[model samples]
Structure formats: structure tokens, C-alpha cells
Target: MAVSSYMTDAIKIDVWSDIACPWCYIGKRNLETGLAEVAGDADAPRVEVTYHSYELSPDTPVDFEGDQTEYLVQHKGISREQALEMAARVTDVARDAGLDYHFDNLKHTNTVKAHELVHFAKEKGLQGSMKERLLSAHFVEGRHVGRIDDLVELAVEIGLDADEAREALISEKYVEAVRADEEQARAYGINGVPFFVIDGKYGISGAQPPAAFSQIARQVWAEHQGEPAAV
Candidate 1:
């Protein structure tokens, strides 16, 4: 007997987020909650979420010699006190979303390598799992996401071929894909994330409440059904 896969009539949700961004993780959690809510509703539409790249601080060095608070103060031109305050607020928000954000130990670095890993995973249909693992590694485990070796380990942990993933990154195979996402984000005028694009038309920004996502998803799925199929 041939093995079959489970599938659904899914609404495409493209999300652009950075692993280093606390809100990105929270947004991911919120989106997952929303998708789960929709999936449970018999009349609601299913969602197929995809992760995309958006570097918050591309110029950051792979070996940034500071904690998150210091980096924010230097890059954003804020006082040390303010940086700590901002981090505290986001930490509280993340905690509410069932995330334990170790801001004090966050290893800040350029997320380009991490983003490239995401694209690699995308080609293998493992983007969602890879995305979550990278985010957790960066925000919770205080891992280095900017280096190729570190990323290779993470990719392997998720059952991806280690050699293939390493070669992909070293050769920059998906660099263009990451750039394409940035270009599309520019076209969309998205300056911040985690930004969500539904069916390539509807745009939702920020870590919105789960209820909000469910409501819009239902509305869009209903509207989508009314339209005739493409020629």
C-alpha cells in the first residue's frame, strides 16, 4: 500500500521575522495559537504558514562584543537605562505569550546565516520546524545563529542532511532567496516584523492577539471561497 500524506485546503500565510527579535517569537506563538483555533473550527479554513527572512540589523558583527542591552543602546542611540527598560517590557510580553526570554543572556549577532538556514529548510519542506528551532535557539538557548558551524548543528538536530545544509550555506545557495524576500518586503513597505502576508494580498503586522488572527483568517477564507478559480 502507498503511504498517503495529510493535506488541507490551506490559506497561505507568509511571515517575515527575525530570530533575534523577541516579538517575532511571540508573534510566532500567537500565530500558531490562531491557526490552531481556526483548524478546530469546522467552518474555518486551514492555514499553511511559511517563514521568510528579514534582517533587523544586518550590519551586526558575527562576534558582537556586547549583550543585547548594550547592542541596542549603541545601535538605536538610546541610553543604557532605556535599553534595559525596553528589554524588560518585551520580556514581560513574551512571558505572557508562554515564552521564557533570557534577555540577559541573549547572544546578539547577525542573523543572515540563520535566515539562510531557513531558506535551505524551505526547499526541503521543513521551514516551519526549522524556523521554530532557530528562534528558540537564538532567544531561549543563547546560541550563535550567525555562524555556519553553529547553524549546521541546529539544522542536523532537525533531521536535515548536515553536509547538504553546510554546503548550501558555504556556497550561499539560498542567498538570492533571502534577497528576494527582502526585495518583496521593500515592495510591501514593511519596515518591521513579524509581519504576516495572507494569500499574498492581506497584510497583518505585529504580534497580534490570537483572536484577531482567527477572525481575519475566517473572513479571508470565506471571501476567498466566493471568488472563481483562476484560469
Candidate 2:
């Protein structure tokens, strides 16, 4: 049986996010929920998701001097009490999205190497899994994501080759790929994490509600249906 292009063609979703960014994790969960909501529809298009690199704090040290709260206070110039309040609000929102964020345990670090790891994972067709693992390790498990050894360990946990992963980071193989993604993000005039480029046409920022993702999916699918199927 001949399949229609609508069923065969995938709607590409390019997501720019930082592993260290709490909102990016929440946005990841929300985007997944939104995609799943429309998966059961007969007319729904297959969605292809690719996570791009965006380092929220590129200048941060690998071993930060203090905790997440202290970093926020220093960088954002907010009071300690305000940082705590902000963390609590974000934690509550994360819980609503079924994510348990442990701000106290989080290790603030530079994410450039982590972003490079993601680029390597993409080549192995495990980018999604790698990205999820990195986020959970940073937000929930309080793992160190900046070091090469640590990232290799996380990659092994997700079935990637530890030696290969380590070598990739040690040799800085995917650093340029990471930089390319950031360059593209800048070209798009994006200065924030958790940004979504849907079908390469629509740009959605922040952790929007699940309905927003589903609505955009349906709208894009409808537009694709109007075009003639490829021969």
C-alpha cells in the first residue's frame, strides 16, 4: 500500500536548551507531553526532535565556588532569600510536570563540554536519551556534568561506549558542533534557553503548556496536508 506523505514526512522540532537550565528540563517534559497528546490521532504527523546546544552560563567554572542559590545571588544580583524563593517556585512547577528538581544538590558548572557530549550522542542516534540523562543528573541527582570523566560515566549508563565518549570529550571532537548550534541560535536572534523551532517556521520560547505544543503540531500537520504529496 502506498503511504501518504503526511504519514511519512516528519515535522522536525529543533530545540535549543541548556542542561543546566531548570526551565529547559521542564520545557522538555512539557514538549514530550504535548507530542504524546497528539500521537494517537489518525491525522497526526510523525515528529522528529533534535536537541541543539545552548549554554545558559558559558562562563561558569567547572567547579563553581558555591551552590545554585549562591550562583543566582551573585550572577542575578538578587538577595539570598529571593534566590530561595525563586528556586521554590521553579521546584513547584517542576513537580507539576512530574520532575523532582533538587536545587540544593545541583552542582553549578560550565556546560560547554556537556553540550559537546550531546553533539556526539546525536551521531550515535541517542541524543534524546543522553540529553535526558544529563538533565536528570544535574537537576535531580546532583551529578557533575562539567568534567570529561563524569560525562563519560553518564554516557555509559545510557549504553554508549565509555572509552569512545571519553575520547570525544578529551579530544574536544564535538566542540565545533556545539559551537555551530550556538551560532545558529544567535543567527535566529535567540538569547534564551528552552526555545523551540517547529517545522523550521515557528519559534516558541519558554516552557509553554502542553496544549500549546499539541496545537502547533496540529496546525503544522494541517498545513502540510494542503500541499501535494511527493511522487
- Please write out the lDDT profile of model 2 over residues 121-220, one tens digit for every residue: 9999999999999999999999999999899999999999999999999999998999899999999999998999998899999999898998888888
> Could you give the C-alpha RMSD of every candidate to the true structure, in order shown?
5.0, 3.3
Best by TM-score: 2
Off by over 4 Å in 2: 1-7, 227-231
Model 1 clashing residue pairs (backbone) = none
Question: Model 1: how large is the Cα RMSD against the reference?
Answer: 5.0
Error of 1 at 185 (Å): 0.4
Q: lDDT by residue for model 1 over 1-231, one digit each (tens)?
A: 121122235788999999888899999999888878878876668678888899999999998999988899989999999999999999899888898888777888989888999999999999988999998988888888889999999999999999999999999989899999999999999999999999888899999988878877887776656643222
Among these predictions, the greatest lDDT belongs to 2
